[model samples]
Target chain A: MEGFLNQLPIGLSIGAVLLLIALGLTFTFGQMGVINMAHGEFIMAGAYTAFLLQDWAGRSAVLVALPVAFVVAGLMGLLLERSVVRFFYGRPLDTLLLTWGVSLVLQQLARDLFGAPNVQVLSPEWLQGAVGPLPYNRLFIMVLAVGSVVAIWAYMNRSAQGRRMQAVMQNRQLAATSGINTGRVDQRTFFIGSGLAGIAGVGLTLIGPVGPTLGTYYIVDAFLVVVAGGLGQLRGAVIAAVALGLLNSYAEFWTNASLAKVIVFAVIIAFLQFRPQGLFVLRSRALT
Target chain B: MLSVDGLEAGYGRARVLFGVSLAVTEGQLVCVMGRNGVGKTTLLNTIMGVLPATGGTVTFEGRDVTRLKPHERVKLGMGYVPQGHETFPQLSVLGNLLVTLEASGNPQSALDDALEVFPRLKPLLKRRAGFLSGGQQQQLAIARALVTKPKLLILDEPTEGIQPSIILEIEEAIERLHASGIAVLLVEQYLDLALRLADRYVILDAGQVVHAGTAADLQGEEARRLLAV
Candidate 1:
């Protein structure tokens, strides 16, 4: 019982991390249908931002890095969209291959710039202590996750720019006819998606080592969360991420770490075989 | 206010429109009539800049707009309602209208203006557009376009697949819009409805404008014969 109780916060923190990484995928993959393999790199970029800011801001670098990393990663996403992804719209296979190539190039660039070894980011003094089973850093991640979700929900539901983004996502042609610049909306969508990845990277720094290939470790898992949750469905992602996080925690406790991943994959595959559309399906009448 | 000179467009390598030409004078209602697969929708899309014109020029308000994007064309005072009563199904009826109004920099009063024209949409404003009946969705679609306060409204078969009562309502709305002096470019398969609304008419066949004249000329046998599949 004590072990089970201990795993609860751990599972929730894991879920929070998964949600942060997959949140952006819900937009780029779900709405735009672009398989951005380099999303992991954006997370790496965010972690690096936090690492770099440590020199200037010291202990509070993590907090300052959040917004800065968002802009840095957002600009990178915007550049990628304008330079490559725009030409590959509606061609999913091409985008997948193109982004995969871009991801490899980014990994090499990181290796050259930061060297091939992993670097550590020091947690703030405020986040160094623990309360019972939950550490302050882990609790911070949960709070950050909830805060990000709320911010995103408000942006999507309340703001005018978000409405245009949703409009463009639902039906591009109709949105264009409605006097929305679809191309500009696409740029904004990519920027936000990549920005979210950056924020996730900052959150990850509290729990683990920051490295160039750090994105690779979480990228597949992030994809799993988004795909299992459903495309463009925010609620679905939250539920899936939490569910998978708990499942991983329990499974690893029962068996081992590698077996936990296998268990999760098996469950997702089986679940998908039954509900192929995932947890929720977007109802739309737009003809491709 | 809008003129197309030798407009050509196609899907990939398969050309659908070939040297199609038509003109709409200020506040004039022009009906484009044709049989199935005659490029009527393609013409409207090309003119709206949803589809690129392969070879030709489109001038709107005396400005060459052939190279402009679809949204740019819309911002230049052109509104389009594509076939199939398209709406953001996930959005509420109010959301459908607000998206356009906000994009076009129109005030909230524009929503009231559109709702005034289609009063049925007032109560349904909070409902999801997808959940509305086909007729209701069509009204919402038109109301969505009207929120833009367009100078030229291009409709591609607005009455298609709708019930008789809603059809009458749409017809009345189009009539009111025309009476209000908004130039309309309507594509309709129903000859009677076309004749009722059109000030001038053009018939397309196999990607070309085979016949063009006043609505009176459409009363002759040649227009019907050309339109008959």
Candidate 2:
């Protein structure tokens, strides 16, 4: 019973991490339909931002690195969108290959810059304690995830810019005719999406090692959450993340981690077979 | 206020508009009439800058805007409501109107004005646009464009597939809009409606203008012959 109770927070924290990583994909992959295989690298960029900031901010580097990493990763995403992704719009296979190649180059660049070995990110003294089974670090992650979700909700629902983004996502031609600069909106969406990955990377430095290939560890899980959640459906992603998190926690507890992964993949595949559109589908009148 | 000189456009080697040229004076309501598959929609798209023009120039308010983007042309006082009663389906009726009003930097009163023009949308403001009936969606689409405070409004088949009652309402709205002195370029299949609202008419056939004349000419046998089947 105690073991089961302990896994609840663990599962929730895992879900929070999943939510953070997949949030960006909800925009880039879900809305734009651009298979950005290089998204993992943007998360890597965020992690590295924390690592580099450690020299300057010491134990509180992770705190300062959140917004900084967002800009860094956002700029990288914008550069990618402007230089390559824009041309390959509507050609999923081409973008997949192109972004995969970009991801490889980025991974290699990270290996060269930061060395092959993993680096440590020291937690703040304030985050040293625990509340029952939930460590303060894990609790911080959950709070961050909630905060991000709320911020994104406000941005998407309340702000003018966010409304324009939704307009473009729903109907590109109508949005253009309505006086919205769709290209500029696309650029902003990419920036924000990649920035969320950076924020996720900052949150991740709390629980794991910061390394060149760290993003590879969570990329598949992130994609799974987004796919199961549904495209451009925020509530769906939140629900899917939590459910998968709980499932993963209990599965790993019962068996080994490798078996747990296999079980999760099997479950997702089965779930997709039943509901291919996902937990929630966006309704739109736009053709293609 | 708008003029197209020798405009040409195509979709991947399948040319649609071949040297189509026409002009609209300020506040003039011109209707383009044609049979099915005559590239009426293609001409509006090219003029709106949604599709790249293969050749020729488009001038608006004495400036060449041939290479401008769709949004740029819109910002320069052109409004377009594409065919099929399009709206942001996931958004509320109010959200649909706000999307355009916000983008064009129009004040809140503009939205009120649009709602006033289509009073049928007032009761349905909070509802999701996708859930609305086809007629309601069409009204919402036109209301959305009107919120932008456009100098010219371009409509493609606004009355297509709509019920007679809603079509009558739309016709009244168009007449009202024309009375307000906003230049209109309308593509309509219905000859009676076209003649009723238009100050001038242009007939297109196989991607080219077969006839162009005053509204009186639209009543003649030649215009009817070109538009038939």
TM-scores for chain B, listed for all candidates: 0.99, 0.99
DockQ of 1: 0.72
lDDT value, residue B30 of candidate 2: 97
Give the DockQ of candidate 2.
Answer: 0.71
Residue pairs in collision within model 2 = none
Q: What is the TM-score of candidate 1? A: 0.98
lDDT per residue for candidate 2 within A1-288, as digits (tens), equals: 999989998899889988988888888886678988888999999989998999999999989999999999999999999999999988988998999899989999999999989988888999988999889998998998999999999999999899998888888888999999889989999999999889888888898898888888888888899999998889999999999999998999999899999999999999999999899987644332
Q: Individual DockQ of the candidates? A: 0.72, 0.71
> Model 1, stretches more than 4 Å misplaced?
A284-288
Shares of reference contacts reproduced by the candidates, in order, are 0.81, 0.83
